[model samples]
Target: MSALPDSRYVSLTTFRRSGVAVPTPVWAAPDGGDLVVWTRADSGKVKRLRHTSRVTVAPCDVRGNLQGEAVEAQARLLPPGEWQPALAALARRYGWQWRITYGAGRLVGILRRRERRALIRISPA
Candidate 1:
């Protein structure tokens, strides 16, 4: 239904400060004309994105096994005003699995005292 990684998992490659590529598998969903992915605000990807918006994404399996070639894209961390709806869109796409995973994360967050979540918006480069 959307051009943004329709696969169950996508490998998002973000560059480090030294230009090294770091790849991570994540769940992605469509938000308006952008593709959004959720992650903790303190994540390495967030840190890397601060320095450079250039990224690449490819359909992959849950284990990060590539299923297709990657596509170049520009990524930005969305501001607070839109993260909630982006998460809702993710729930719609992933359904119960999303709830389960998010719930588990919430519990972990409670134990770890974390509430900083972020939504990353990606568009064609």
Candidate 2:
């Protein structure tokens, strides 16, 4: 499935145990038949994905506001071997802006001793 447009900011909604959804806006890029995204490892989305693959995604603006209807999807954390490649794909799709922002995010993560961010792949459910 085409998971939004290649360079769209998608609102990724991950579910809580009680079935409530928590949404966050994220930059995503097409990765073969799936979509790839990178986010802080400790984020709520990652935590929820660990518990369940159930997720919904939709085109959105930078503030997590939805601009389209959500579609069902499943997400998985990608293997470490693919992290760099996934990031490269994102850069190719988003250009220098992504390169700068992603690079800086990594730098800040290191400086803050934060958990390293994770790369995820999302596919149609």
Candidate 3:
């Protein structure tokens, strides 16, 4: 694995076609040989990954303050059918915190009549 720290949040940076980097903090958990992250399917990071897998990851706080050295990585958006494993990994790492977040998101989606989740797998580059 890369030197990604075991922090509560990771600063996931993605690039735009113009080469500008956008960073966001997200919860991440190790799954097999990759790090899995949960996000909304329509999130900007997911959209960026579709355009290019190139990315950088660094341990950070929830506010996106980098707390460790950044590492180059490749990110892949997992198909919907493959989301379970990623969710499981997150749940294991976060426990009740994740459950509450998951439940709240599900409830909101049901009320809004649309729910789409994305799973991203980050591998060393």
Candidate 4:
């Protein structure tokens, strides 16, 4: 499904156990028939996805202001070994900016001893 927008940022809405929706702005890129997102492994969105794959996404600004209609989708946290394509997609979309951000994040991850980066695959539901 061609649900993903061409915008640089997307607001990913993940649900809580109580069914309240929590939205967070994230960078996303079209990957084949799905969209790939780069995020923190331990982020609340990822945690929520673990319990429920249901989510909604919409084109947004960097500050999370929605610029388009939301589309229902399912999300999955990709395995660590499968992160390369996701990283590549983001890098292609963001260019040098992604490189800088990824580098900084990796350094922080190392210093903090955390598995800082994770990939999320989103498909139209």
Candidate 5:
């Protein structure tokens, strides 16, 4: 298979106990030669990720049209601090509103409650 895009919003698919949950339009960052994603710690995605680390991330166009190779990678939960900087950088690059929110710990808490970020180490699978 061909290589995936370096950085872009991707549709992340994870398996939940109830069924499969597909979270679309998630921001992913290329860090330490891997792709990382952040989500609520208590999110169903997190729960699903715990059971299976394998995941698929695909790129989408302006109209939310998917294209390119869907990356298959191994996922692992990252400590909050471990991925915060990268996440912040991505937010700034994408003009997201999280940078200002990070200044306030309470706001961060409110925003990230039950949210656990994960790093997906991409490689030929």
Candidate 6:
């Protein structure tokens, strides 16, 4: 497994059923040297992830440009309360408006893990 990223944001790319790339913003956490992300159980992202555990999570600059090797890793949907603090921290940091939507159903803490991927390259600003 590769080292966890050092940035707050990661570009999460999942493969669609049509075999197309679907990228989105995902909050990440370094758990026991592994990368973790939270999403709703019924979310499209989660559904796609279930199909393709292979995914990329990379650090980016303020402009949303890739900064380093988007680490490639496997993703797993974690059950609620598995990682509460991490999930809460992400909500506070991102100011997620849908926190209650997930929290209300007690569907919080659905974490995805990224195992390893090639380092992405980014030019110095």
| The best candidate in terms of TM-score | 4
Indicate the TM-score of model 2.
0.87
lDDT (C-alpha, whole model) for all candidates: 0.87, 0.85, 0.89, 0.91, 0.60, 0.59
Ranking by lDDT: 4, 3, 1, 2, 5, 6
Residue lDDT tens for model 4, 1-125:
54667689999999999999999999998888788998888889988998999999999999999999999999998998988888899899999999999999999999998888889999999
Please report how far candidate 5 places residue 11 from its true position, in Å.
Answer: 1.3
Comparing 4 with 5 on TM-score, the higher-scoring candidate is 4
lDDT for position 13 in model 5: 65
List ranges where model 3 is wrong by over 4 Å. 1-3
TM-score of each: 0.86, 0.87, 0.92, 0.94, 0.67, 0.61
Error of 2 at 41 (Å): 0.8
Ranking by TM-score: 4, 3, 2, 1, 5, 6
lDDT of 2: 0.85
Over 1-125, each residue of candidate 3 has an lDDT whose tens digit, in order, gives 56555678999999999999999999999888778998988999999999999999999998999988999999998887988898999999999999999999889888989966778999888
| Model 5 alpha-carbon miss at residue 99, Å | 1.6
The residue pairs that clash in candidate 1, if any, are none
TM-score of 3: 0.92
- Give residue 124's lDDT in candidate 1 (0 to 100): 78
Record all residue pairs in model 2 with backbone atoms less than 3 Å apart, i.e. clashing: none
lDDT of 2 by residue, 5-83 (tens): 4448998889999999898899898877778998888888889999999988898899977788888999999988878
Q: Residue 125 CA error for candidate 5 (Å)? A: 3.7
- The segments of candidate 4 whose C-alpha lies over 4 angstroms from its true place after superposition are none
Q: What does each candidate score in C-alpha RMSD?
A: 2.5, 2.0, 1.4, 1.2, 3.9, 9.1
What number of clashing residue pairs does each candidate have, in the order they appear? 0, 0, 0, 0, 7, 10
Native-to-model Cα distance after best TM-score fit, residue 66 in candidate 6, in Å: 1.7
Clashing pairs in 4: none
* Model 6 C-alpha lDDT per residue in residues 1-125, reported as the tens digit of each score: 56656677777777888888877775564544565666545667777867767677778755557778876766766544465655555465556553664454353233334322111221111
